[model samples]
Target: MKNSNIKNIIFDLGDVILNIDVPVASLSFAKLSGREQAEILTLFKENDLFRQFETGLLDEASFRNLIRKLVDSPDWTDEMIDTAWNSLLLDMPVERVELLKTLRSKYRLFLLSNTSSIHITQVNKILEAATGIKNLDELFDKVYLSYEMGIMKPDPEIYLQVLKEQNIKAEETLFLDDNSDNIKSAAKLGIDTILVQKPVTILEYLKDYAV
Candidate 1:
């Protein structure tokens, strides 16, 4: 049964609200690094630099430098690195933002994104061009970025911190994410969760809840 006491909503950005193409990033990196897409995938998936970058252990410059080293190209420009890294991000749907606006009247809204700095700049630019909004804070009550918080999802600490800081009851909050592990982690902490599968949208899922 859906929780009637859900007074706050915590949303995951990638794939849940934002349109992301993970394979696009692999293709971009393949072209930039002169390596096969499969190799690029394995390198990044197994590399700690990507996780470190997401959790703020690695700054933007250091992250780019690591990418440059991986590509074995001493002269890779920052733009090239950013393009490859941000290739996964597509566009934010207007409907999702509109849904957020409507839900804000009844529920406190928050954004918890496991994302990097360069991706955020691109996201803002795209969102503003489409919706005329400056950034996500205009839609959400608060935005918790993994890079800024030095914590990422599935750790349980980040979710706990958000609940404590926002003074929200775990049982009264609904968390939505595209990752199963993330959904499980939140559920374990007493927060209701939806594992948002692809082709299933936040707007569709929240219809009855928001109403």
Candidate 2:
């Protein structure tokens, strides 16, 4: 397909622009819960707990309870869980913020992330300190977080919602996300997408995609 139809841009937060370290998060949680990483991760996936949290099926407190239940440990406190989960939002890439800003001036830029309160709180605080940006509110034309939207990426509905809210056609939106599944899901709806690999920033990707 041609780039002629592209008008809006939607971005995924973690790992794409925010630089999530999955290893760090897993190791941190493993240490906190005093369990083997494999064991905890097994339960996390098996229970669909991660999906539930990202997709907004569970709130912060409930997610903590779910983790505590998995560990069967009374030591799993709120601070401990928050610390572990927030490890993923390690830092924001400076070049990415610049790229987003440049794109915002051109396209109707939006952020659609599958994130929860614990990480979102830390990300906002860090961005304020790092870039002096007000917060999520000042960042994009609209910010659609899964915890608030009741939908997450890899689901077509979430992308549809973005298009619907912006009153833009799927053909007119280009989605930038780190996950291949998410890219494919958006592509299924005829939306342009770029699957980001490490060490390549958004600026480089957009140079090829943006007309």
Candidate 3:
């Protein structure tokens, strides 16, 4: 594949730009609530709470309250819940940051992620601590977060909304995501897409464009 018509690049956050381990967070929550990790993971999927939180349908306090109830731990403080919730967010590699910097010179870069406020805050802190970059805004031309937009990936409306709001053409945009469903949705709308999978980071996938 060549990049002859790719004017705008939209990148995913988790498992694409930022490293995340969902099982790690599940384990942390399990330990906190004295439940099995498998059970904790199952609970996370039972009520669509994760999706609700990512799409801004559920506020932080309400999400936390629901989590406490789900875990059967009524006494867990806000800080404790937040820590467990943020455990999945690992780090943003410096090389990936450098690649974004290099690519910014050629393409209008954008970030599109399904995320929550708590995770975004922690990710900014991690980015600042690691590379002295205050936030993701420093790396991309613009950012589109699901919680802020009240929409999420795999939904055609979100992709269409980004295109409409940015005044960018779908044919000229290339979307890279870790999730196949998101990639498929973007592709259906005439946007080019790459499914970034494990072991092959964006740096490897988009190495040609970094130049």
Report RMSD for candidate 1: 1.1
Residue pairs whose backbone atoms clash in candidate 1: none
* TM-score of model 3 vs. true structure: 0.96
Distance from true position, residue 206, model 3, in Å?
Answer: 1.2
Please provide, for model 3 over 1-211, each residue's C-alpha lDDT reduced to its tens digit, 9 standing for 90 to 100: 6568999999999988889997888899999989999998888899888899999999999999999989889999999999999999998899999898998999999999999999999999999988999989989989999999998889999999989988999999999999999999999999999999999889888988876
Model 1 lDDT on a 0 to 1 scale? 0.90
**TM-score pick, better of 1 and 2:** 1
Stretches of model 3 off by over 4 angstroms after superposition: none
How far off is residue 6 in model 1, in Å? 0.8
lDDT of 2 by residue, 71-166 (tens): 887677798888888886778867778777777777888898988877888998888877888587687999999988887788899888888878
Give the clashing residue pairs of candidate 3, or none: none
Model 3: ten consecutive residues of lowest lDDT: 202-211
Error of 1 at 138 (Å): 0.9
RMSD each, Å: 1.1, 2.0, 1.1
